[model samples]
Target: MSKPIRKAVFPVAGLGTRFLPATKAVPKEMLTVVDRPVIQYIVDEASAAGIEHFIFVTGRNKAVIEDHFDIAYELEATLKSRNKTAELELLSRYQPPAGQTSFTRQQLPLGLGHAVWCARDIVGNEPFAVLLPDMIMKAETGCLAQMMQVYAETGGNVIAVEECDPALAHQYGIVGVGESKGADAFAITSMVEKPPKGTAPSNRFISGRYILQPEIFDHLSRHEKGAGGEIQLTDAMIRLMADQPFWGTRFNGETYDCGSKIGFLAANVAFGLDRPELNADFRKEIARLLG
Candidate 1:
């Protein structure tokens, strides 16, 4: 029987070199998109997707991430005194119940698989979702939540993938076609991360969200280095396809690669447009700047 996905892993270990100077002291995941940090949106997405436990894989300079999820005692007290209930409730939503949130550290700048491996104990032997905090998707249902619905039927590994330009397929983990898992989604026959020039199996690339079965742990345990002399998650995931069914679902949303400075700024601007408090003024300012 297909089990529910109760846990999610947020791989937040990378040093945001692309966002230097600003990221030098602050964790990139903690960088605000629109009054909320990038990580907050990811967690909120997972929560909306019915995730019961949130596991974060962090690195140095990321204590702020922990602080972000915790209640600001002084701030809450002040807001309470001022009778700012709306603002207070907004802050409270960020906190998970006691023991609901957990964190582990990835000491080295290893590959994505290594970051996920750091959280294995928390995940145990169950199906879990992994989301890279760098890829921000603006969706009403949230990408992970949508993937969960697909997982309930596919009953195997599922990932969020989007179509990229044929020439740019080498920049992502492209997938091969199998069967139609959904009306539009494709069951993955194979996947290769950043294939050589003109060698990709398909134009669909792995987006940042994934719901994987526990069998992946076995593949990852014996996984060797690939693509960057680091244990790439894509490599292990590829092996997983051999033994288990793997499928990728395409969602309706624009994904900003906040791993890069340009993408980060784009997300900030896009999110601001969705905020009632900032949209009007921010758009005016942006328009004036462009002029």
Candidate 2:
């Protein structure tokens, strides 16, 4: 049997220039989708998917992200004094067990591939999952968990994929479909980073969740820059793919790219409406705002 996937790497070093003023001092990952910071949702998903070790590849001004996972003693005390049992319990539930979390700084804006490479020492010689916090997946089964199911069946690289409009496929990393592995999973014949409009191999675009073998570090160590003149993770994956089999699964859910303004606002509404206490009122508020 393949080694159990017990660790997950989160690449959170991106400078959120797109979000601007709001992200000036706050790490974009700390921005909230609802009541929880964006990174919390990603970590919750990883934990639900059986990831025991939480590794964060962070950057400057990102200490808040780390602290969010740590205990807030003064606040906890305040909540306790106020007898806010539910609020205090919520905080405790979110804190990962001691030593289960580790943070390493990326230091430079090298790109996603380099960020993953920064965690090589921690990942060692085992397969691991990489989750981009910006891509929040809403599903009955966490996207990474869904991909883990595929990994268990096919012991190689696995990526979560979603179909995009063919005309817009050129704007994302597109994949080619091969033979079926079973269910929504399939062999990935090709991966192209933003191919020209009509030349995309398929409409399926990688949705920022990956299960990769440690060998990928060797390929990324070369620091070869590809699209956008940065160390693109897709470039390293393509090199790794030459030797290892790759599989893709279309997760049963919606993905919100919180890095974009529109995607962020949409996620808030989507997640807010998902809460039992807020659903009815939130839906009505949305209708009112629309009018």
Candidate 3:
């Protein structure tokens, strides 16, 4: 029987060099999508998928990220004193229960694999999910939840994948499709990180969500560097694939790569439209702006 996926690792140590001045003081993950930080959306997604323990691999200047999930006594008191029940309730809903969240620092900017490896102690000997904060998956059923469904049946490693433009496939971690495992999943024959344009196995690219076994820690511990000379998670995954099975599920959702300006702006627009209170006015404002 497969063990329940109760923990999730969030890698949020990256320096947002691309966003420049805006990201100079703010950690990229703290950048808001609509009103909530990008990390909040990812955490909400994991919580919806039944994840109980939230492990964050963060770095310097990321203390705000930690505090965001912690209790703000003064702020809560102020809200309560003012009879701001709705605002207080919203804050409470966003705060994780005490002891449910943990934070560890990644002293260096190693890479994605290394950031994940930093959480080895917290994850211990269990299967856990890894979510990239930069990718905001907008779906009725969260992306990680969809991958969890696939993991429950397949019981190895599961990756959330989505079809990208063939011309842009080389820009992502492409996977080769194999036999169908179900309506939404397929056996992954191969995985190549940023393959040359036309040489990509398929148009399907990994969509920043993962369900991995504890054994992956053993591979990542080796600290082998690939691609850009940093410990690349793709390299460790490729090595792990030699023995274990890998499955990919094309989730019913759209992904916004908030690490990029375009994707960040798009997510704000999309999420704004998703809000019941703002949908009508938001659309009219967007239409006016476009006009």
Candidate 4:
């Protein structure tokens, strides 16, 4: 049996050029969606999926993320003195157990594969998960948790995929499948990153969640640059597929692409509407705005 996927790598090293002035001072993953920061959602998802270790691959100016995960002793003491039980409980829940989380620096604007590769020493030879903090998924079960079930059966590499409009298939890393495992699972025969407009082999695109084997490090370590002159994780995965089995599971949820402006606004609204305190008034305000 394959080693259990105990650790998850979060690639948050990118400079959020798209988010502009806001990102100039803050890491994109530190941006708030409704109430919680984007990285927190990814961490929550991974934690729910039984991920024991959280490895963050960050870059310069991203120190806030590391601090956010650490305990604030003075604040905790102040809350305790004030008898703020509820607030203290909430704060405690956000912190992972000591030793469960680790942080490393990428120190370059390379690519996803390179960012993941930075975690090589910590990951060692164990199968680990890679979750992009930008793709915040809303599901009955966390997206990574859902994929974990598929990993238990497949015991190789598994990626989360969702169908996209054929016309827009060129915008994503498309996967070609050989057979269906079930309504929500398939065996991936091949994967192509951002194919030409109408030449994509399949309309289904790879979403941000991945359960990868350790052998991928060997492929990524080559530092070979692919599309856009950077080391692409998809390229490494393609190389890994030459030897191991790869499967794709269609996750059950709405994934908001928070990497873009519109996607970020939409996610805020979607998450706002889901909040018990805000739902009713928020829905009415949205309807009024539409009207």
Candidate 5:
């Protein structure tokens, strides 16, 4: 059997300039979607997918992100004193097992490639995952868990993909398909990051989740800047596709791009609507807005 995917890398080093003043004080990953922090949702998904080692590629002023995963000693103590077992158990899920979490400094704003490269030492030569914290996915099953199922069965580089409208293809890396594997997965032949509208090969756009082989480090190391004069992970993945197999799992999830203010607010509203206590109030507010 293929070795189980045990490690995951979270690229949370972005400045999150798009979120502006709100991000000035808080790391975007710490921003809440309803009640849970954005990064926590991704962590829960990874944990659910059986990922044991969690690595964070972070930068300056990102201490809050690290602290969020750490055990809050005083808070836990208070909860224990009060015997609020239910509340305490819920909070404990956020605290990763000791020694299972590791953090590395990206130290630069080079790009996603550099941020991912920063974690190579910790990742070693194992196939590791990269999950962008800005994208929060809500689905019947977690997106990462869904992709992990595909990776174990297929044993190749796998990415979470979603078929998007052709006009919106330029907003993401578009993947070209070779053949249909099954219901929700496809073999990728080529991919381009934000190619000009009509020039895009296909509408299967790359999302934030990637199950990348360690060999990608070689391609990323030698890769020149693409798209935005920054070394893009897609560029390296494109090169990796030439040699090995790359599968795209048409993601089954409602993804929220919390990198933008509008998307972030929308995620909060969407999540609120799912809450039993807030659903009625949220629906009323939404109706008022429409009216």
Candidate 6:
């Protein structure tokens, strides 16, 4: 039997240069999609999938993320004094229990692989999940939960994948499928990061969610730089696949890449329309703007 995945790593050490002034001090993971920070959505998903520990691989200027997850005593006191019970309850809903979260510094702008490697000590010898905070996934069952189901049966490396236009294959790590594992899962023969146009094995791109065995640390420790001269996680994963089973599951969700400015604005609109309190008015405003 596969060891249950109890820990998850959130790699949020990037400088978020795309957002510039807004991210000058604030970590990109702290940016709100609608009302909740992007990282909270990911953490909530992990928690729903039975993740017991949240490990954050951070960098300089990321103290705010630590503080975001930490309890705000003054703010809680003010809310309590005002009898803002509903607001307090809402805040408490997102706060993970004390000692369930851990933070460690990546200490460099290496790459996604290195950032994940930063959490190796905490992950130890068990299977762990990796969630990229910039991808805001919307689904009825939650992407990570769907992945957990696949993990339960497959018991190996499981990656969340979604179909993208063939023309945009260069923008993502495309999976080369070997055989069908089930209706929504496949045996991944290989993965190529940002393959050149027309050279992609398939249009099914690897999204932000991953359930990896702890042995991957060995490959990442080499710090091998592939595409863009960075320690791409795809490279480490490719090496890991040489001796282990790697499977991909098509996620049951719509993902918005909030790492980009346009995608961030679109996520706001998408999430805004989903909120009951703001839907009608936000829909009207959007219709007016488009007209």
Superposed model 3: Cα runs more than 4 Å off: none
Clashes of 6: 0
lDDT of 1 by residue, 1-291 (tens): 798899999999898888888899998898888778888888998999999999999898888888888778999999999999999988877789888889999999878988888888899999999998988888877898888888878789998999999999988888897789657467898888899989999999998999998888887787578888998899988888888998889977889988887898899888889989888999899999999
TM-score for predicted model 5 compared with the true structure: 0.95
Q: Which TM-score value belongs to model 6?
A: 0.98
Q: Give the alpha carbon lDDT tens digit for every residue of 1-291 in model 3.
A: 999999999999999999999888999999998899999999999999999999999998999999999999999999999999999999989989989999999999889999999999999999999999999999999999999888888999999999988999989999999999878889999999999868999999998999999999999999988888899998899889999999999979889999999999999999999999999999999899999
Q: Please, what are the lDDT tens digits per residue for candidate 6 over residues 1-291?
A: 889999999999999999989999888999999898988888998999899999999999999999989999999999999999999999899899999999999998989999999999999999999999999888888898999999988998999999999999998899998888778799998899899999999999999999999999999999888877788888999999988999999998789999999989999998899899999999899899999
Per-candidate TM equals 0.96, 0.98, 0.98, 0.98, 0.95, 0.98
Alpha-carbon deviation at 240 in model 1, angstroms: 1.3
lDDT of 5 by residue, 173-275 (tens): 8888888776777888888888887989989888899999999999888848876788889888888887889998988879888887878888998889999
Candidate 3 pairs with clashing backbones? none
User: Candidate 4 on 147-229: residue-level lDDT in tens?
Assistant: 98888877899999999989999999999978877566789999999999988989989999999999999999999999999
lDDT of 2: 0.94
lDDT of 5: 0.88
Go through the candidates in order and give each one's C-alpha lDDT: 0.88, 0.94, 0.94, 0.94, 0.88, 0.93
Worst 10 residues of 5 by lDDT: 221-230
RMSD of 6: 1.0
Model with the higher lDDT, candidate 2 or 6: 2
